[model samples]
Target: MRGEGMIKVTLVRGLAGKPEPHIQAVKSLGLKRVGQSRLLPDTPVVWGNIKKAFYLLKVEQV
Candidate 1:
C-alpha cells in the first residue's frame, strides 16, 4: 500500500471535445496527453481538480 501524502494520476482518456475547464484541470494536473502521469501531493485542492476531471484520469495512492 502507498502512503497518504501522495497520489499518482494518469491520463487515460483524450482531451479532445472536452469542456474548457475540464481540459484546464487536466493540464493543471500536468497531464497533456493520454497515458501521461504525474506524482502529486494529496491535498483537497488537488482532489477537487481530480474529481472535476475524473472521467479522463485514473488516480491511485503513491
Candidate 2:
C-alpha cells in the first residue's frame, strides 16, 4: 500500500460552513484539519470522495 498505486489527499482549505456531505467525505478520508493529509489507495471509492470535496482538497500521486 506504500507503492505506485497510492495517492496523497491533503486538506488544503478550511471546512467551515461546508455542506454535510462534503465534510463527511473529508472526514472519511481521515483528514480533520487544514494541512492534514492521508495516503490512500487510488481506487474508485476514494476518488469519489475526493471528487465530492475537490475544492477543499489537494490531491497528488505518491
Candidate 3:
C-alpha cells in the first residue's frame, strides 16, 4: 500500500550475540543487517516489536 502511514525502523546496532527473541524481533521487522531499514504499517503489533528490540533499532515516523 503506497502512501500509507507508517513508521520507519532501522537497525542501528549489530545483532551479534543478542538473545534469540531480540534477534527474532529484528528479523520480524524485516531488518537483515546493521543500517538496514524497513517501512512498516503503523500498528501496535509493529510498535511492540520495535519496543522489544529498542536497543538494536532506531524508529521514526514516516
- Tens-digit lDDT string for candidate 1 (3-44): 368999999999999999999999999899899999999888
Tell me the spans in candidate 2 whose CA falls farther than 4 Å from its real position.
Answer: 1-4
Better of 1 and 2 by lDDT: 2
In model 1, the worst 10-residue window by lDDT is 1-10
Better of 2 and 3 by lDDT: 2
Candidate 2 on 1-62: residue-level lDDT in tens?
Answer: 43349999999999999999999999999999999999999888898999999999999998
The per-residue C-alpha lDDT of model 3 at residue 14 equals 95
Q: Which pairs of residues collide in candidate 2?
A: none
Better of 2 and 3 by TM-score: 2
TM-score to native of every candidate shown: 0.91, 0.92, 0.90
Give the better candidate number (1 or 3) by TM-score.
1
The all-Cα superposition gives candidate 3 an RMSD in Å to the true structure of 3.5
lDDT of 1: 0.91
Clashes in each model (backbone N, CA, C under 3 Å)? 0, 0, 0
